[model samples]
Target: MPDTAASSTHLTLLDDLLKRALAHGADAADAVMIRSDSVGASWRMGKAEDLERSESTDVGLRVIRGKKQAVVATTDLNPAGFDELAERAIAMAKVSPDDDYCGLADPALYATDLQDLDLDDHPDQGAERLIARAREAEEAALAVKGVKQSEGGSASVGRTTMALAIRGEGARFEASYSASSHSVSCSVIAEDGNGAMERDYDFSSARHFEDLDSPADVGRRAAENTVRRVGARKMGSGKMPIVYDPRVSGGLVGHLSQAVNGASVARGTSFLKEKMGQKIFADGIRIVDDPLRQRGLRSRAVDGEGVAVRRLNLIDDGVLQSWILDTSTARQLGLETTGHAGRGTGGPPSPGPTNLYMEAGRLSVDDLIADIQEGFYVVELIGMGVNYVTGDYSRGAAGFWIENGRIAHPVSEMTVAGNLKDMFRQITPASDLTFRYGVNAPTLRIDGMTVAGA
Candidate 1:
């Protein structure tokens, strides 16, 4: 929960807005309010480059008349505009085309109790502290051996308060929650003095500032990564196993989530549309979406639609189990809402995963790649060359070459291509999973990928 007084005030405003909608002949209505504040600082070459702060309050209201719906948003908080906003929404709904699936969550499905997830931990660490953090990171990076120059270091702190209210049949639903984030990032260039140079970056983000990695550590990591990529060359084209480091392996899991989104499934735009209850991954693979994780980057007690949310095993023992779904998409697909709704002031709610991750596998990273005579250990991916409709995948890649079961040298200007269905079936995860991002996975090895070098 956020500040009790603030939450109460936002809820009251939303409730009043909903009442106005109902009074304007809307059958049902819902409203959401978001308040956010953030501060950021950037440093380069021992000097502060920039420091900035922002604050905003925005709201969205949706009204439904029979099967038609309309959504409106505003940054104006004056109560005097509530009547016009409601009236505009009601008029739009009256003239809008019917959408059989448009409506609020069922009253019975609304989350009644808000649980404390320990998401807020931002204190009044002012601009001076932020600048100090950024400067420390940049200075540390420049201290690393083989690190030639600094790109920049940045630190940011942010807090958001969200409230949702729904008008139901003789019942009213309202909920409020708050979260805070702190992050530090450093990017630098490393050179071998033979004109070989490469750039890399590292960052740490957490709900609590205490949980974030120290500025020095982040800078050192960024420098080390950049140094390793110096003197990079290209590996010749071949079809072999491709190993994805933990940092980039999460993308594979994210692709799976997108394929299982109810919107795509309903529209037949996902290659996995027919894969429900089928073995989509290797045996023993499990993927989970948990919105209730205490300190997770995307944790939430309830979904954006004011529906109760729980952890879901999206994949259980390699079998596809559930689609990521919001209310409208679930209705269109003739299934119940999976409570994966994500909302923004400018658009209607849509399905998305929160705190999604694949469970770690049995083998260590060293053991997982022990037998690979030739492979690509991918560290970075570029371009969005994925075709969700066909599951065909291709991407520009840069990483190290694995030769004779060891990382040999840095490689660049490469392409990795394969169908996702085949790649998913060949995935072998390692026991190196870490919860450092919204979507996470262990280091993964996928066999039979086409690796081409320029």
Candidate 2:
């Protein structure tokens, strides 16, 4: 984790920058500082391939004059340079095109009573541990029978600190937070006697080092996944049921997110633009976005814009409940901000989800697949063939074929096609939801999809 002394210094620096921007004839301003340190190691075939360590600090300032705003970024932390940075921002804002919705958030809505989400952890041991982790993972993967070659193993640990300060009419705010992350991953190829080779990989990440999966466990899982695809064959073309494993099921939820993004909806480019208060999914389905989840991968007490954050039901009872929004997009749609704003050093704030997930269903994985006699169980997806405007979905897929309600053989080089509108309506959720990614869903089964293969 980052030291408190450094965090305090960053907050002070942001405050000084915001004050300078205001003094230079800007109506309102906000400044953010980000500092990061990371260590990584990669090992392949029992030898260390690379070792890396990095540290940096970056700052961005947004200044608004009247209805126009300008943003500037810099890596130089010298206080003497702040005057020129502020002056440049104000001058740019003066000549910038007018935008009615380009200012700070409402002062009344500023976040207060921030909570500790426990996102940071103790410091890492060093590069030595990371190298050992990578070596161990590669060795474990090579130990598995049928495994032909190692694709290398990797481990990384990182910490980031963010500080923000806002100076607007009747409102002044400052906040700082730090978070840590650790990850281990392994990839390997398996070959059958016929000279056919398949590759698979697995990895686990968490906010704390102690929560990550063991290197051996990751290696074994990756090897097992690779071994299963040793004898993959292409199936025939036909329309059938499709069951998505947990690894790929989250993509469906991501599509939903894009369809409901406030920016896309405002631009009239989303298929779900007119889906408010409509049944977009099967009955009894619920989807949630919670930013306050303890130790969540993307958890935060407040959004990137210093707005209060909370849990929201983006979907409830299979109905479209809310749109992912920020202050600017919300204003364009004549709605209040949903506190979903996110930002980086080079651009303005935008709306996005944090800790988004779908609720699990009552049916088990086996029960979900029991009813499908001839279907495709998708484990991997390829291509970006989704049309958000029309909801037309088509993607290259690979996985196993289902015969007699059981996994039969691996299939590859297949394309699955269906309209998302129909797919969402025909979807069924299984009781295997896990919180492994920022966006999560259970094992999903969608009926009435077409599969094309040899």
Q: Quote the RMSD, in angstroms, for model 2.
A: 1.2
In the range 245-364, model 1's lDDT, one tens digit per residue, is 988999999999999999999999999999999998989999999999997899999888989999999999999999999999999999999999998877779999999999999999
Whole-model Cα lDDT of every candidate shown, in order:
0.93, 0.92
What lDDT score is found at residue 221 in candidate 2? Answer: 91
Q: TM-score for candidate 2, please give it.
A: 0.98
Using lDDT as the measure, the top candidate is 1
lDDT of 2 by residue, 143-258 (tens): 99999999999999998888888897766888888988899999999998889899999999999877899999999999999999889999899999999999999999999999
Tell how far residue 114 is off in model 1, in angstroms.
Answer: 1.8
What ranges in model 1 sit over 4 Å off? none
Clashing pairs in 1: none
